[model samples]
Target: MLIGIPKEIKNHEYRVGMVPASVRELIENNHEVIIETNAGIGIGFSDQDYIAAGASIEDTAAAIFAKADMIVKVKEPLAVERAMLRQGQILFTYLHLAPDLPQTLDLIDSKAICIAYETVIDTQGRLPLLAPMSEVAGRMAIQAGAQTLEKSNQGSGMLLGGVPGVAPAKVVIIGGGMVGNNAAQMAVGLGADVTILDRNIDTLRSLNIQFGSKVKVIYSTLDVLEAEVLAADLVIGAVLIPGAAAPKLVTRDHISKMKPGSAIVDVAIDQGGCFETSHATTHQDPTYIVDEVVHYCVANMPGAVAKTSTFALNNATLPYIIKLANLGYKKALENDQGLLEGLNVINGKLTCKSVAEAHNLPYVTAKTALAI
Candidate 1:
């Protein structure tokens, strides 16, 4: 199989789909790999690096798009790259289609085998592919929110872990999943007053056990959420609903009533956002003021740490890529129930029920779509 890796074109996105070592693994499997020239350059892997790993480099993304059997990418293809998609070409990437209607429509028209990394499941029913990035984004949320708290950024100017003589900042994280858990870990390590809220009693219990007296874990309810946001110096929106749009837990009214200079990091911005006022921002301009509350809602937060993110993501995705290349997508998807969950679109049909319900479109089971 011929696999292609295109340089990520999203704003401030520097991670490559496949690194040199990842390419070498595919090459050893007798697969041909092509990458756009300098695709890994931002992550410090030069074109020569990929070449040395047995990958052919193309001068333009157009050429890579024109030929490869499968297009491995780091982010959802932008408009231009989406236009280049060929029917039946395997697109294995993070396609957060639930919130982007135009992308969903374009993908349907392309009739490609769209395997979304974000929706892929593991044997334990966990999102294995999405977890790595979630971990990165979650940890970064604290870093970004702390920066946003500086007076220079129009934030409330509160230090995350205040001086010994001063009280530590109050950090409130919504959701107790991977993102929330990681965020809480960072915040607690910084000696901040950290609190995590979730609807799942078991998750809350687990978090309580994990943090003990160092952090607070609470049951999530409307009143509890409102109270926490009003008191928090930094609020991290980390909730997720698998492939569906994130629920808007923090309303506009919640933003207005928050103390002036307070900051919010909406880590769930990729799946729409849990905060009503959150809009996707780029690293170049990563914040906006909403009712005196600073909003940090970069959709690709992990992209800010390109090298770490690329390597971590590659570690998780490479085995699946190998399977698709060696066994062919159909056989691979058929053999792995978890991989079949990754199928969003194939042969012009919507195979992901979440995406179909998001757009109120017709849906078919992956098996039905493939006539397996």
Candidate 2:
């Protein structure tokens, strides 16, 4: 199999699909790997580095797209890259398609085998491919929120962790999943008054045990959530619904009532955000004010730390890439039920229920689509 890695074209997305070490692993499996010129440059992996790992470099994304059997990418392919996809070709990457009807339609029209990394599940039912980036984004949410809290940034001039004489800022995190857990870890470490709210009693109990007295775990309900958001100096929206669009837990009314200059970091922005006022922003201009409440909803927060994100992502995805390359998409998906869950589209059929429902389009089960 010939695999291609193209440089990410999303605004300020510096993470690549694979690192040289990942390429070397594919090469060892006797699969040919090609990297577009300077594909890994953003992450500090020079073209020579990929070459050293036995990957041939191509000067044009067009060539890579035209020749490769499978296209490996970090972000979902943009419109132009989507146009380049060939029928029956494999696309292995993060495809947040529920909120993206255009991309879903494009992938459907392309008739490509689109295996979304975000939709992939492990035996434990956790999203393995989306976990690492979630961890990164979770930790960074506090950093981003802290910066947004500065008076100059249109935030209440409050320090996240106050001085000896001052009280610490109140940090409220919605959802006690991976993103929320990591966000709480950072917020608590910075000496903020951290509170986590989730609907899952088990998750709440787990967090209670994990942070003990340092973090407050609350059962999420409408009244409690509203009160917390109103009182918070910084609110981190970390809720997720896997491949579906994120529920808007924080309403515009809530934003209007939030203390002026208070900020929110919507880590769930990639899945259309848990905040009603949230919209995808870029790193170039990440935050926007809504009702005097600052919203830091950068769709790709992990991209801000590209080198770390790239390596972390590669660690989780390389094995899956190798499996697909060696056994082919059909065989690999059939072999692993979790991998099959990653199949969003194949041969023009929409295989992900969440995305199809999001678009009100037809849905096809992966097993039926693949005749498994």
Q: Evaluate all candidate structures by whole-model CA lDDT and list the values in order.
A: 0.95, 0.95
Candidate closest to the true structure, highest lDDT: 2
Q: Model 1 scores what on Cα lDDT?
A: 0.95
**lDDT per residue, candidate 2, 151-171, as tens digits?**
999999999999899999999
Which parts of model 1 have CA positions greater than 4 angstroms off?
none
What TM-score would you give candidate 2 relative to the actual structure?
0.99
Model 2 pairs whose backbones collide? 156-261
TM-score (C-alpha, index-matched) for candidate 1: 0.99
Give the per-residue lDDT of model 1 (tens digit) for 243-268: 99999999999999999999999999
lDDT of 1 at 24: 98
Candidate 2 has an lDDT of: 0.95
